[model samples]
Target: MNGVELVCPAGSLPALRAAVDNGADAVYLGFRDGTNARNFPGLNFDQRGAREGIRYAHERGAKVLLALNTYPQPQTWSRWTRAVDQAAELGVDALILADAGLMRYAARTHPGLRLHLSVQGSATSAEAIAFYREQFGIQRVVLPRVLSAQQVRRVVAQTDVEVEVFAFGSLCVMVEGRCYLSSYVTGESPNTCGACSPARAVQWSEGAAGREVRLNGVLIDVFGAHEPAGYPVLCKGRFRVEGRLGYAMEEPTSLSVLDILPELLEMGVSAIKVEGRQRSPAYVAQVTRVLRQALDACHADPAGFAPREEWVAALQRVAEGHTHTLGALERQWQ
Candidate 1:
């Protein structure tokens, strides 16, 4: 257990500023292309923006990690390699990457540059992490959201590499790097095109009874007159199972680990990541502010730490479906 670094997401320059200003120890961002997972339109950074963001973060005594975390096809592999070069040239503190080929390129070409295994790499076990560290000298690994706190501790104890876990924001129900649900509907996925539930394939319509959300003409979910609506990601939608109608995979809920800050800190996690690169600067500010307060409180008194009501309320305001869960951190949630 040590002082946990608060790593926040910065999809844009303004979001990066918001995260740093709100007390982030480090900020992670992606290039404005298919190289990063959050390659949504109007999000992420261009070359100039990435340079400016790194300068801003460094000036403020915060670190910047560039994400080249997508799986690139053979035809598009050069783009990913070029992005690694760009990140190294930009003086990023580290590069979060998932592709083995690109990882090798970065490690071999820029021996001094730090490499972090992206969650999309799906390295949950100690052996998987050790392999990456041995083969490519990966300094850190962002664990997928499917592991429990105990499982996380086991992985950490077994590896010499630093471990980073998601603390807040949207939850992906499926295992990272293997999810094909979005691809099945939109013909694109985070593993390939760098986005699941791409905006271009999403459609919303009003029907006589209620509202409807469709992804590539496939019905994702339907909302009643007064029910809340959510993004049409395939996993978060409703489905019928055994003649019962409900969310078959998972509901549209954000992950909030404020209550378990002490457990994570005690587990010796290197960093606590906030997962919202596609969010606005305002969202970044609010989330960072709350988590900053909580983490500070936990560091001051881990044994007696309690989540503040105001912090929970503030996070819930921006939570998807107006609900938050511990994700797989709590055994029951798994």
Candidate 2:
């Protein structure tokens, strides 16, 4: 990293301010419609809200990146294109897009606007990144949470475009663009519908078994009196494998790269991004403050950069399942 940039999530105006005020280099957010991935109820910004958020970020010397990251269906092509125009008109610092068609539209129509390839695009290879940089002149690419630190170094060494990786937040087991387990259960996918497990389809009730949660009438999880109920996403749900009920797919855990911040910066990662856009402003504020302190500490003493126990504990407190990992950034089995 030439300069350490901490990119935070902002699902709302207050979240945006929280990030900027806490020393975030940039805050990424989406509109109130299907244009962004975190399109849940009571989240995202309208035009007026986007403008206000952008102003607040700029005034604080931070950047506001607009996420128009969902794919545009044939029936909704104009809607996606119009969103690109709106982001430009609203003066967002950059446009984070995924679909090649949308990226082309942004490149040709709003050539001057900075474009970041969303992690949904899954450009983990240097060749994939090169194609985007050559075709649309994308300034940066947000890598999916599937690459190790050495892998990140390889991609950075080969590509001219900037690279951003998730530093803290929810850990997904698959490349975001390809995950369809949720769609199989809920008929909605975050890549297109802007929600992994859309809130509208979730059903919860107290039963003699303690509690049960379902998505689109599909049983996702059943919790006993002592078991904590995780989110209703199918991938993170408990399942029966070999007659043993457990996390057959993936566990409820968060990704925290605090242990490897020095390695990431040393590898020349252009930015570190936090991954909670659907969380509360308080979540945004807390995570931002922690990452800011850690990043500053790294700069103040690069050779002495070691993750503080308190930082790990603070992030773990809000982590999914109250646990954290380096994700695929470091595979212990390897």
Candidate 3:
């Protein structure tokens, strides 16, 4: 419970400020390029914006984590290295990286700079984390959203590397660093291009069949007359399966670990991440506030901790599909 940072997402300068102002202990953000994931239109930070954000976050005693989470092509490898240099120059508190080469470059070039393993690194076990920690001096690792609470606890028990788990925002059923549905349809995926279902390929149309969305001309979902549309990703798309239209891969939902705050604290979890950089600043502010409140309550009295109704309601307001899950973090039956 002590020194457990609330790591919130900041896709833009506005979101960064909102997260910091809302009691976030740290904020993770990406550059406006392929070097980091969550590269979307009108999103991410430019050099100037990153410097300002660093200042804003530092002034409030909050750390700023620069994400260099995407893999690199041989021809475009310098882009990732340059981002690492710029992050160090701009005074980022740490670098969240997935690529081994990038992590090595950062560790070698700026030995004092802290390194964190991004969830995209796919380090599910302590052995994998130990490799990064021993090779590149990664001080922390963001666990992918695939581990049950028991599994995560086991990993933590085996590794000294700080653990950061996603506590809120969208669900990725495919697991981080490996999902290829976007590339299968759009030729670009978060792994290299830093965007899934890249905005350029997303098509929305109104027709007699209520509404429909497509990615790269492939039909993804057809909405009902009164149904709400979610993110234009194929994973959550409702499709005709066995003669009935339903979600086959995964449903549209967000992950919330409100019910397991005490368990996380008990496991010596170093951080809890909020996973929305594509969302608005309002979303960041609201989620950060609710999580901040919940963390404070849990830390105050872990044995007596219980998520407040209002806090849960506040999180649902910004949750995908207007609902939330404990995600892989819950496995009481197991």
Best by lDDT: 1
Estimate every model's Cα lDDT from 0 to 1: 0.93, 0.90, 0.91
lDDT computed for candidate 1: 0.93
TM-scores across all candidates?
A: 0.98, 0.97, 0.97
Off by over 4 Å in 2: none
Candidate 1 residue-wise lDDT, 183-204, digit = tens: 9888999999899989999999
Which residue pairs come into collision in candidate 2?
Answer: 1-268
- Give the per-residue lDDT of model 2 (tens digit) for 1-334: 3488999999999999999998899999999998888888999999899899999999988998999888889998999999999999998889999999999999999889999999999899999999999999999999998888789899999988999999999988888787887788888888778889888899999888778999999878899999878788778988888999988877888989998898888888899999999998899999999999999999788899988888888899889889988878886612
Give the candidate order by descending lDDT. Answer: 1, 3, 2
Across 134-237, the per-residue lDDT of candidate 3 in tens digits comes to: 99888999999899999999999999999999999998887799888899999999997999989899899997887989999998998878888776788889
Q: What's the lDDT for candidate 3?
A: 0.91
Q: For model 1, what is the alpha-carbon lDDT of residue 199? A: 91
* Evaluation by lDDT, superior candidate among 1 and 3: 1
lDDT of 1 at 59: 99
RMSD of 1: 1.2
Of candidates 2 and 1, the better by lDDT: 1
